[model samples]
Target: MDHYSFFDRDLSWLLFNERILMEAEREDVPVMERVNFLSIYSSNLDEFYRVRMPVILALNKLAKGGKQEKEDVLLEAQSLIEKQQQKFGQIFTSKLIPLLKENKVTLLFNEQPPNEIQSKITDYFFSQVMAFLQPIDLSETGKNFFPENNRLYFLVSLTLKDNSKKTILLNIPSNQLPRFYSVSSDDQQFILFLDDIIRHNLHRLFINEKVTGCYSFKITRDAELDLKDEYHGDLSEQIEKQLLKRDMGMATRFLHQPNIPLHTLHFITEKLSLQGSSVVEGGMYHNLKDLMGLPVSLPGLRYSRWQPLTNDQLIDAPSLFEYIAQKDCIFHTPYQSYNSILRFFNEAAIDANVQEISVTLYRVASDSRIVNALIGAALSGKKVKVMVELKARFDEANNIKWAKKMKAAGVEIIYSDKALKVHAKVALVKRLVDGRIKYAGLLATGNFNESTAAFYTDHILMTANPFLVREMELLFVFLAKKAKTSAGYPIEFKHLLVAQFNLKDRFLELIDREIENVKKGLSAGITIKLNNLEERVLISKLYEASQAGVKILLIVRSICCIIPGVKGMSENITIHRIVDRYLEHGRIFIFNNNDTPEVFLGSADWMNRNIYRRIEVCFPIYDQHIKTEILKIIDLQLNDNVQAVGLNENLQNVILEKHEPLIQSQQEIYHFLKQEIYDRV
Candidate 1:
């Protein structure tokens, strides 16, 4: 048995968010780019509260039978979140806002603006914002006021002539209109947030009532759902109906401005029944995440956007299938256009020899060309089987809509069985080649989304190997029946490891080999790149390997619970996180077994949900050229001085700034791919 120093998952996620916040504070980043990072941090935090925080809260509520150290984990998570929030405030106030001012962009309050700026703001508010305003009085009735989640609201402290104060709420119409409005003053340009615009017009909103003072605040609700077992209708419908009511869910965090009167805050808190640890006090602005969606009209306020380069093989091929048959091709996305994926589906749909197609759909774009191709294939008499995962949170509604479309188009749709959520990104096509059965498939590390493909670094393997394709065929058969996958799909698979059967044990066995090799005084090492690392068994095995003198290099993008560089424990392990132009979104594992390097890529992360609950596949890279390319890419990312964070024992995001030449991997990868295409041409 191996022992490991495991950081709490919540704390690990906070570290990732901290990295994003650091980007917003970086002077090298453009003003708009910094704001975008801020937005990313805020949005990522929202998902954390909605998805992961609920689970932690639930675990804390469980009896002693729950995880043994539940309270310890929850308390650590709460404290960590609070501390990060303070950092977030400091960055926004001390760094970002000041930079904006230096650039002639000002987020002004109503207190002391120049006369002309104030006049312009008042005019703009009356003309554009006043029509959308609807203020509600919270004094006479003490009614429980509810604002939509993430919406900014002002809790006005109205004082009559008799000096009696009453509270009222005014919601800023930011969702419908622009969050920031730019105005001109001589040679300087000014930008004001929509919240401030509402603040400037507070007196006008309450004409008959005297407005003594106003303060800004917002509420964040505990947005989790526990589906009841008694629903008789479709599960998708039940979930959809429940989601409609998500806006009015129980309050999780009530964020109030620090300047709000104690009496007013207390009365509102008591009336809304938000007692206990749910209330959080903070800055004047509520949703800084809206800054992410800020329009970029200024000439040089953002980084230069790069257009996705097309693959040489895809661009020059006479036909997608014919080209794919020649050799295995790998696509590292955002650098290489995802049009090849759309082409694969489009070609398969029209190919008369294609008899059946089976694919897993987790998330898809709204105007998904892939869905259209699947429908076309079904209409053309090909058997199209789609396993639409309607449980993909925040995307459930869209998946449900697409599911109905696929069903209506004569495609056989297999909604995942309630127990498991199918997250594999494998696509299988059975075709007749020269009067014989053949299969060509594409396995991806990300979704088949065209929109996200431009910003997420993902991997997609296109192959025609019968040995691998046969196993994919068996996977489809097994998905249709909810049975344990067969043990005999390809008994000689010296490479690929499929979960729910032998993947976990296989991973452990591989680590043991590394451990054994290190004990024999051989050069042994392991390098892993993943989205998360939270599974205990895997972490323990890795720790054991590290203890046995294996040099461990980890590139974990989010939620890494294993702490590194601790004496007598994780001294051999080092971790890095990259947050840059594109999201680092692939999983790759390399174990140096006595100088005979073994590499694999696939859908499964080291996370528990992926290993135990979901169906995933990790296939070894058998092609020497592809393996070299992957290693080169990894090396480039490791050398990145920009947008990379080295994790400390305390998991502080220490920027890698050792005076080395700057190397941003995403940019370098794009140049590499573009050069490859040019050479082929």
Candidate 2:
């Protein structure tokens, strides 16, 4: 049994979201940047409910009366989410908006209006926003109104003097039009929500009946689409059809204003038949995630943009291939330019000895220059094969678009079995050097997207080791055949932890070693940095190790289930979460076997889907200097008292207080890297 056997995974994820909110609530952070953090927190919560919570809820409903534990966890998750929503309300209303007002920006509503400014808003709405108003009458249509995913809606309840009440749903055209409408009169910039603009023009929207009141609201649906393997058609066409069906998915959540009347709430819930579903009562503003792009337009309100810094190694090298031949190089994205990854493919495309290029396309940019480079390679008589996964959620349409384009350019496209989505981010290049097969591969922790690479923290390893290259080429062949038995690629691996075979064993062995070492009175410990940690077996192993007196420190970015510091169960376990300016990605696991530690960097987290299902690799750090550098970064994050949150025995996120000077690890890392560049220069 795990130390955190009682701790729920869904509730732990909500705590992660709360840490993001803490960043927004920090007085030390820039105001506009804090607003962006708030938007990210909201967006993250939306995805949590859309993907995770619904599945948990569904899982609870299975086995009928049994599994009291699952039901209790769900109830706890629901309660925690409501608490977070209330905190979000307080932060947005009491703090962020007021700060914006101090900067002369106003988020206006209908009730609280200066008389002088009411006319300006009224005239602006009638002229510009009235044409966009399309209200749906629930009584007239006599059908349930369902909202599209992430789309905004208005819940208007009307009370006539004769006591006959009517309710309607209004669609706010924020996605089509701008969410924030800026109006300038004298000095102040009056920015109104798209819903508020429609609200001001309500007298015109209602034809005959008097408009009593209006409130902003919206509904979030379960965005998961069930695209089974039975569909015998073009995957792209099938995905396009699913994209259309997504808007009409079951409404899992109803987000509405708190002040809404009881009858009105009953009316909407009964009409939509949302009898057993979750109903989340929220503040006046429905979709605060839109505030990420708040149209601040003011230069000083946000952080100054920093141009991506190129690696000094790239600048000093004779050529990319030549440099790889000498030594392996890792490009940590955003800090190091994504242009280097692009250059690797582009150079391969133009190299004379290059024979073939194979890549796994999980998620790529719409305007992907990398795909264009692959197309160029194919056009230049290079055998280019792309295993494009068309099932990546939210990016399926974009992946489908790229697939059609790549296929049209004469590239061999391999579609994986629909049951398993190929999520490995790998690109392999085979070149004939003196008539011998020489290969180069790019393995990354994030999607091969240049735009997100600028903001997301990911590690891309570019290497040409013959043994590793041979394995990578074999892996590509396996991927092409969808890992079939007839595929020539061997399943045996000593240096790589490839999933479906050896990864789980390797991880379990590492934990078991720690447990044994602790029992032997030797120094034993484990340090892990991962995006999420929720695998039951893995968590249970950590608990067993902790019981054996093996110290464990986990820096999990999100979705942790292993409760730390339980008195008799997990006294040696500690969990830390770092929420800084840069996302803490790059999964690294270290096992301290009496001070002779083994460190590995990988493309997989400890989540069950990654360990048991996905084709993930955990490769050992060979270069001593690189290992030192990665360890240094991890240590900095561990020592961070500013952005770090400690999870206690009760699974509570408690911020560590420091009486001395603060050390923000992200900023410290920037300075650390800058110093390295300076020393090299």
What tens digits encode model 2's per-residue C-alpha lDDT throughout 283-363?
Answer: 777778888878777667777665666777676776788788777778776776788899998998999989999998888
> CA lDDT of each candidate?
0.80, 0.79
TM match of model 1 to true structure: 0.92
Q: Can you write out model 1's per-residue Cα lDDT over 1-681, one digit (the tens) per residue?
A: 344567878878987988888888788888888888888888887777666765675677673566555544667776777787888878777787777777776656333556778888888888989988888878877477666776777778777777777777777788788988878889777777788778767777777678776777666666765567465757777778878887776666678777777888888788667673356676777677888766446668888988878766567787777777788888989888788899899989998889989999999999999999999999988999998887787788899999899999999988765556788889988888899887888888888889888888999999887777877777777778755344454433345677776788899998999999889988888899999999999998888888888889999999998889988778999999999868899999998888878888888998888888778888877678788888888888888878778988887778787565778888888787788778867
Q: What is the lDDT of residue 102 in candidate 2?
A: 89
Instruction: List residue ranges in candidate 1 displaced over 4 A.
Output: 1-3, 58-79, 109-124, 161-165, 185-187, 228-233, 483-495
Error of 2 at 664 (Å): 1.4
TM-score for each predicted model, relative to the true structure = 0.92, 0.94
